[model samples]
Target: MAWDPAVYSAFAQPRLRPALDLMARIEPADAARVVDLGCGTGNVTRLLKERWAAADVVGVDSSPEMLATARGDGGGVRYLQADAAAWAENGGAVDILFSNAALHWLGDHRTLFPRLLGRVRPGGVLAVQMPHNHYAASHAVMAEAAAAGPWSEVLSPLAARFPVGEPSFYYDLLAGGSSHLDIWETEYLHVLEGDNPVVAWTRGTALRPLMDAVDGAWATGFLAEYARRIQAAYPPRPDGRTLFPFRRLFMVARKG
Candidate 1:
């Protein structure tokens, strides 16, 4: 199953407002070489370039489909198809490593964290934001709905898995590191528009992997059941809207 960058961009911009806000806090003068890891379509990457006009900006992602959608004529900005973890491991040095709404997909951060930290030059910063909604109803519903009927046999084994971690988990990883680290979590109550905004939001991000794991017929059934569960879990407001309380984790570490 291929990633629909268009579908993703439609929802990502609005939902990812917090991420952009966090990225804005960085001082451009402090960064010379900047990299946006998991840069889906280069939305945030563009912001980085605008902030640091003289810096060399690179957008790295593993998806060819996503890279294809990224704009390449930004002069100093270059989009590369590369695994973020692998790139960091190979000592792809930079002054700032910026990431948004992407790290959660690469669940095991124990090794990835140190490797990325090593890639940052002295006094450089690593700013990252990831959704911490694995335990939320939208995701919980998927596991619950999948465990019933015919889907159980296939989904049960994977039910115990979810793609997010607690705030303390990251604090522990950055502990004892020489860099100055600031890690925190927040819940954003997004006022989503449309009749089924919750479904629309998940369809673009969280539900992609599950959709790929099942057959076409089963995928349809899975989404239908998942939608019903989500409707109950996150009911619509009186004004034909839903308040999506999305939780996210962020960490900003500066290498000394």
Candidate 2:
């Protein structure tokens, strides 16, 4: 799916908060090599570079649109065009394998998590953060809208299955390989401005696939229906700010 760097960047500060919170919990003594997996737009990747100035930092992403924007502000970090899983399989080992707001896009955590952990050398850390709000109204309503429109046939097939499992699922997967493991969840209540801001937010991420698969009157109608339902689901407060509670999962695992 194509990504709109502008749309994603609209909520840049809110998006960056989870990554910042996850990074703070990591304890890497000296990160000699760092890979920012699914490092969209390279914004957070640059922060990783700043955090480990002496390390060789590489930003890996699959989207050309996102990578193009990332490369525009290179900031001495190398950007690679590749899938996160493929990169994890072949990109060699690193001291810090850090991913922010990525990984949830990929499935098969049973295999993916271990492969990622194996890529870390002894004492190295695999630090990751992924949106865990699949069941939240912001996302749950996507399925509702997909099934409610003339575009149902096309969009229903595209409806997202919740990708990120519970915290226990990951803990069990990484326990054997990790010398130290930390897993937690955080729900951020974002006070968003503007009309249907929650819809605008998902448009950048979760809503894109359905939006991409159709066009003409059906596409327009589908979006309108989704917007209608979303407005009702997340009504504006008395002061007019919309409260969007987004939950995210964070994991930091160190190899023995």
Best by TM-score: 2
lDDT of 2 by residue, 124-227 (tens): 99999999998999877899999997899899877767889999999999989999999999999999999999999999999998999999998899999999
| TM-score, one value per model | 0.93, 0.98
Q: Please list the residue runs of candidate 2 whose C-alpha ends up more than 4 Å from where it truly belongs after superposition.
A: none
The residue-by-residue lDDT of candidate 1 on 165-254, one tens digit each, is 676777777755635788888888888888677888888987787777798778788888888888888888998889988888888888
Q: What TM-score quantifies how close candidate 1 is to the native fold?
A: 0.93
Worst 10 residues of 1 by lDDT: 156-165
Instruction: Give the C-alpha miss distance for residue 208 in model 1, angstroms.
Output: 0.6
- Identify the runs in model 1 with alpha carbons over 4 angstroms from their true place: 72-75
Clashes of 2: 0
Error of 2 at 177 (Å): 0.5
Model 1 residue 167 CA deviation in Å: 2.2
Model 2 lDDT, residue 141, Cα = 87
